[model samples]
Target chain A: MNSSSISNYINTLFPQFEPALREKLIEQVTIKDFKAGEHLMQTGQYFRSTVLIVEGRVKLYREGTDGNEFFMYYLQPGEACALSMICAAKQESSKIMGKAIEDSTILMVPITLMDDLMKQYPSWYYFVMETYRSRFEELLLVIDSIAFNGLDQRLSFYLQKQQEQLQTNELQLTHQEIASDLNSSREVISRLLKKMEQKGEIKLYRNFIELKK
Target chain B: MNSSSISNYINTLFPQFEPALREKLIEQVTIKDFKAGEHLMQTGQYFRSTVLIVEGRVKLYREGTDGNEFFMYYLQPGEACALSMICAAKQESSKIMGKAIEDSTILMVPITLMDDLMKQYPSWYYFVMETYRSRFEELLLVIDSIAFNGLDQRLSFYLQKQQEQLQTNELQLTHQEIASDLNSSREVISRLLKKMEQKGEIKLYRNFIELKK
Candidate 1:
């Protein structure tokens, strides 16, 4: 997108920003493109800049010491990673990982400008706070699912969320991929998917699962 | 404590605030006392004001639909509940519950003043952001524990955290209480406690647990 289109898109997403502040943001931000399946971030890596998703989707997950990946959530267009902003602000390293799930465009703002933006723009401060609050709530919900809900329930919920995010009933992921995302073994995920298919909740193929309403 | 002492204490705890802003906070805030076991906040309840803990400890937990309580973390003196601040700013209801773990004194700042404070005081904005960042990280850690760690390891980590927070090796809680906090059955927790005791990791007493290390 051209500079004017980018500015308009950002203004549309965060209309609370003053025109001058919006212009400043447009001037300072550098747009970066990532191909599908590219790593946007990794655990233990320092955040050099905070990102704002201008287009496409990003998958976020937490990595275990043994290289296990547990799916966290996804960031869509107009959404920024709350952890990135916070870690960038505090000069801390990331404990989670992010990847581009599709061809994506992101606006990256340098960490040096964070303090100035907060002081100069009320909209920036509000946007950051809202992002943190929503993400915090999402993390708590994830904990609730793990702590209280059964594995089957969590699997169903996970599938539903995936469908919602992809905007399709068909999910193009293998049972092994699902297992990795949920921190389960391939055999267990396969069994669960078979059970779900038997119950008519989903139809499983070789490498895809279709959710049935 | 007297008003002057309270002011001095708050100033010490949140040294980021400017003198004038601190004076304004002192003028606007009201101190409230809570006995141990008193509910500071409940799920689905609107936060009329945000709290800053001045004395004692507060326990935070998420409650399931069936009333199962999964302990999240604690708010010690000088710490504020980031959720409360965010919910107050957004005028949203709380999804987690907070209770006084001991006789506690808290300074309550009305929700109406949150906007004014954010706009007028850069220190207040920074403090809010820091609070959100730390709490977000804590939630992510909780997710890691539940998703990847074994129950026994989680129990050990939970007890260690309790000991750290209460500053005592001897924790005053029943097996049932611990089970509720961890969202496990009493039998399961009792079994784990017995195993820990057998390993010389802890000594279990009636309604109490003493860490050996």
Candidate 2:
């Protein structure tokens, strides 16, 4: 996309930005594209720039010390990873992993400009605060699910969230993948899937799960 | 405390604030005192103002639907609740609870000034983002504990954190309180404590736990 197109897209999301400030943002940001199944970021890595997802989806997950992965949330168009912004501001390393689940376009704003943007633009400050607020609330919900909800309920919630992100009831995932995301073993996930299938909640295929209407 | 003393205290924590901004913050913020065991905030309640703890400690906990409380973290004298800031900024209600664990003094900044402060003060904006980032990371750690660590290990980690916060190896809490914080039964916590005591890790008492040297 051209610079004007990028500026227009940003303005659409944050209409409060003035022309001059918007132009400055457009000038400072660089656009990058990632193919499907690409690692946008990894654990223990520092983010040189904060990313704004201009197009497509990004999956964020937390990796445990033993290499177990648990699904955290997704970043859609118009959303940025709050953790990335936080780490960028603090000059710290990320503890979570981010991957593009599909072909994605992201606007990269260098860390050097973040402070200036916040200081100069009220809209940018609001955007940053709102991002942090929403992400903080999301993390709380994730904790609630793991702390209070049963594994089966968490699995169902995970599938529902995934379907919503993918915009389809049919999910292209193996039981093992589901198990890994939920931090459960494949045998346990298979047993739960069998029970779910028996109850007609989902139809399990060789490598996919179809949520019944 | 006097206004100048409060300003001095805030300056100690956030020295980046300009003298003018610091004076503005001091002028706008009202200091409120809380008795030990007072509720600073509760679940599902709206935050009318953001609080900065000027003295003593605050215990932050998440309440489950059934009213079971899980301890999330603590807010020391220098810190503020990031959720309160977020909720205040967005005009949203809080999902967790906060209580003054000891006699405490807090500076309450009205929600009306939040935007103006962000617009006028770079230090305030940085403080807000850093708060959100640290709290977000804390929530992730909570999730890691629940998802990866066993209950016994979580209990141990909990005790260690409590001891660190209280600045005493002798924790002044009942087994029931510990169970409530960990979202387990008193019987379960008692059993685990008994095991830890046998292992010479802690000495259990009627209403307190003493960590061994």
Candidate 3:
């Protein structure tokens, strides 16, 4: 285990911070690294601190009654892990899991510290409110997609979003992962991919697929 | 129109002092009344204010690409109309129409004034935050229902929710409206209703259906 400059990186997200305040926040945050497949928090755990991804990727998922995992979304660099969970701490039963997709380091700050920061720093309060608002809007858009769009359309939308977010035309993703996000079976996804390929919508490659214009 | 004691009534939803601050909010709000089947806001116009239902009921709905209107949910007394619109004001297009379900009176609070309240009052800030959270969570549950739950189960859940929210066994709903909410066709909903009737799950009445426990 090694100490990292994660706090310095976190200050970059709060670019409006004065030098003195930035130093204080950096001193306050604690950074931790986890290996891939490690669960940061699971159902029934008390998460008193909110975590920000300093490096690497994390995925948040919910397990259904039959043990099927539903993809809520992924936490990328600069994104907070479960902002909603931190704000509304009343959820006794955790419906989602934050799993590291890669070797990841995150900066954590206590909620009480956050409260003090909001009061003492009005600009910081605006930043926190904006962060929550963005996530809230994203969740609503996801709900709209689920309500209005079909399975294939959702799969297409997800792929498009991932490609844009990752800045790559091709992704090294498995059918099972796609199925998890789409809330369908791997076999169904395989068939759909085949159909999509046949229609010249996408080109399937080894461990990746390229979208067609 | 004669001025109604709407502010006195809205105070019931909040604590005493908080409602006094909200009464100041009333001056900034316009009291608008509508009959059943009247539109408060439509798809093309910019929605500038969040309406509070002081009396009667309202429904929030959007149209599909096929020009079919999908009723999302009903807003009861003391609830906000199209609250997501308030949170995400960046939307260039209106997705839903707030229609009065019956003879309804609504207090329209402009977005700027609501933002002011959110800044001045921590209690109102928490209230708005919780309101958005509830709406977002409700939508997530809806997504879960659409993806995993069977059609019959979904229909049962919808009926149960309406019963609880509306506080009535009988719902004055049309088949087309039910189909839109369930994301199915009228024919499918009709068939399911017949099947439920045979199984004693629900009793169909004139202009309404009763969910049998």
Winning model by lDDT: 1
Global Cα RMSD, each model: 1.9, 2.2, 3.0
State candidate 3's DockQ.
Answer: 0.41
Question: Model 1 chain A: which ten-residue window has the lowest total lDDT?
Answer: A1-10
On residues B94-118, what C-alpha lDDT tens digit does candidate 3 reach at each position? 6566788789887776776655675
DockQ of each: 0.77, 0.74, 0.41
Against the true structure, whose DockQ is highest?
1
Fnat value of model 1: 0.79
Q: Which digits, one per residue and each the tens of the lDDT, describe model 1 over residues B117-186?
A: 8778888878887888889888888888899999999999899889988899999989999888999889
By TM-score, the best candidate is: 1
Of the two candidates 1 and 2, the one with more favorable DockQ, higher being better, is 1
Winner on lDDT between 2 and 3 is 2
Cα error, candidate 3, residue A118 (Å): 3.5
Q: Ranking under TM-score, best-scoring first?
A: 1, 2, 3
Question: On a 0 to 100 scale, what is the lDDT of residue A156 in model 2?
Answer: 86
TM-score of chain B of each: 0.94, 0.93, 0.86
Residue-wise C-alpha lDDT for candidate 2, range A82-122, written one tens digit per residue: 98899999999999998888899888899999988887877
Candidate 3 residue-wise lDDT, A1-213, digit = tens: 323375558566667766665776787777888999898767556666777787888877665666766676778777775444444333334556688888988877766676566556666655555566566556555665676777788888888878876678887788887988777888988888998899999998868988888
